[model samples]
Target: MPTEPATYPGYRFPAAVIHHAIWLYHLFSLSLRDIELILAERGVVVSHESIRRWCLRFGTEFAAKLRKRRPRPGDTWHMDEVYLKINGELFYLWRAVDQHGVVLYILVQERRNATAAKRFFKRLLVGLKYKPRKIITDGLRSYGVAQREVLPGVRPRTSRYLNNRAENSHKPTRRRERQMQRFKSPEHAQWFLSAHAMIYGHFRPRRHLMTAGQYRRSRDQALRIWRQETCARVVE
Candidate 1:
């Protein structure tokens, strides 16, 4: 009920079409042109550049609205960082997820030192609105320093195997990275990932734990919610 209030004004294509195009691109390892071709197969006949524009403009808005409908994250958090090579330059991609494997946030920064770690912790606190009861991560000394200064009183579990959830969250991103031929720069990576992480996560609900019937019901529910979130006028 918090989303779905948006209405398409001057857009030529219906909001349904635009939302579906953005969905295809973010939920899978598809490029803009890949989405263009898929839509063409359905007789939509739109250019790749137009789809790109739609995603660039509407994707973030849609993700923000959908997040309003999400459940509160688990109290146990997992944190990890990966090395990203963009434009032949090295950068760190910081990410956090709840114990349930729900992505909390993503950040790109130049350093993995204590300063950068503190910035990431602050961003998470602002977005999540509460400190986690416990955080699991590797024995990165930067996390130790940041936890002392930023997340005081939160329990920190430093181990090699405890944070597999956060580490595995980067797999889909690696596939998308190769497909897009790597991001043009840090801004580009963050822009795409900011939307991709949320939108893609919405329809994905840990299928391995569900029966086929359960998965279908979950997916149907997600799509119904998507229609409610992105469509200016509900379809059928």
Candidate 2:
């Protein structure tokens, strides 16, 4: 069995274009139409439909590569869930990020309960390859129960201000949701968010903690990692 090749016949946009489109989609809170217009201004006329497809395909691929190359997050993990409405239906997006605000993993589920919490925890453990030392969540009783069963020795911290790190991390995702006018389905939402999380994790530097020199170094390191990953894929 042979894999079918992806065809983009009429327009010969470089990999850079696909990369640029994905970056713009995440970096700025831009819609597909908005991205098309931005690129049009730069003399690259691409349809919104094309841009959307590029985001789904290249965005996911790029994110996967970046995830593979980047360092694993620390043992202190913060978890949170946000509600999203897609086509009048409600769903939850469970996000777990480490101490430095690097996204560890994400899952979209219909409900936020003990079972959902356990499922998320299982996914997190598998993806991260280590049980976190401490887990923080916003007064979610399910987290307390799940942690006891799955990650028994891990300390569970449930407090108002304590979970602010996870709460603050949702801002970029919320901004992106507003630009797209909400997702069409759970599958679409999951795909887009998974890609976005990877892209976000790549570019975002720990600005709050680093000095000016240290910040620049971190920024350079991220870009270096991204370029290396992109080049490796090209070679393969």
Candidate 3:
């Protein structure tokens, strides 16, 4: 689907600067102040507070645009959940990825029970627009219950050994979580991670599996898409 142009009316900085700040914040482990300094070094004098506002305003918008450009996810889906602490309270971060490590969706919930698993499953089915042929997950009993209720026909494979794809996907989130000193709240974690998954997933081609030439070409293509998506004409 073609993306309609976006406008940055009433903003002091240009859209490119806003996009740059957001991209930097999500694509790397940089604090708001860190991003502010980096932009200043490049002669773009914006405050860290302004950077924070830009991310809150436009990060998900940008992610939606990029997701629209993605191909359909693979038929084999992998799901996993990890505990995240927000304000010293525990929340579950449920994530799903395809066999190729492309993120499907993320949900921040208070429980990792059958209810939560079912909710995540339904969201993924609706979001992805199709049922996956098979779901891979760890030995979470909730998955078995949720699979029956939500996606009965789809095969569910249970075993820790088979779910490395989804588990490995958490590594980047873990890194970013530590870098940011943990999320302030569940809503905060959801927005930041939802954006992170899309942006990071776009550029993170499996270089280990590709030839050097293939990796370069894939990277160049990703860069082109990022440029086009961000630098396109903004309506007034």
Candidate 4:
């Protein structure tokens, strides 16, 4: 079998290297400068700004491919909204994860009212193209209102404890927030987290349910698909 070479036009670095840098940024709470230093130890001399540019260029493209390749998510979705402070302004980060803890989607909005909730619901329905069987959320009145208007048929369960999965999923975002000293803007936060959530979830399977060998194999398969999506020959 012949493996076609990846042509990352107008870039001198190989596609694998670029994708690896992007992977390092998302898979952990590493900053651009941190990624630069890590790659420096590997004999690849590149500036942090260059890595940031690479992330901006390819992160969304790679994440979209990964999202499309993912299996159908669980029917029971857990949704949550948390406040984010970007530039000292309040922004609401709306997130949804399935019962299996796979991130379904994320949105950054300026409000957390019924209108905002409906918007998130609509966006979710567009991506899923179907209604989830049930949704669990915190005791937010907006969720109840949104469910009635947007998803009239789906049952909604209000529980702060049962929605812990969605809350726990925000931990990674928190870590990244601290690592980056907070996002510069709402757009930047959404753009970065959009890719980060999908890619991060892809590599982090439920290791507790898997044997050591199964965990390793799962991670390896994730890497393989990540490479293909980035049009790279291998994971560097």
Tell me, by lDDT, which candidate is best: 4
TM-score of each: 0.93, 0.88, 0.93, 0.94
* Root-mean-square deviation per candidate: 3.8, 4.6, 3.8, 2.9
Q: Report clash pairs, candidate 2.
A: none
Query: Which stretches in model 4 have alpha-carbon errors above 4 Å?
Result: 1-5, 232-236
lDDT: which is higher, 1 or 2?
1
Candidate with top TM-score is 4
Query: After best superposition, candidate 2 residue 34: deviation in angstroms?
Result: 2.1
Compared with the true structure, model 1 gives a TM-score of 0.93
lDDT of each: 0.89, 0.83, 0.89, 0.91
Please, what are the lDDT tens digits per residue for candidate 3 over residues 33-80?
999999899998988989999899888988988998988889999999
List runs of model 3 lying over 4 Å from the truth. 1-7, 232-236
Worst 10-residue lDDT window, candidate 1: 1-10
Q: Write one digit per residue (lDDT tens) for candidate 1, span 1-236.
A: 46543447767787878888999999989888888888899988999999989998999999998888888999999999998999999999999999888889899999999999999999878866777899998878999999999988999999889989999999989999999989999999998988999998999999999999999999999999998888685333
In the range 1-236, model 4's lDDT, one tens digit per residue, is 66544548788787767889999999987878999999999998999999999999999998999999999988899999999999899999999999989998899999999999999998888866677899999989999999999999999999989999999999999999988889999999999999999999999999999999999999999999987788844322
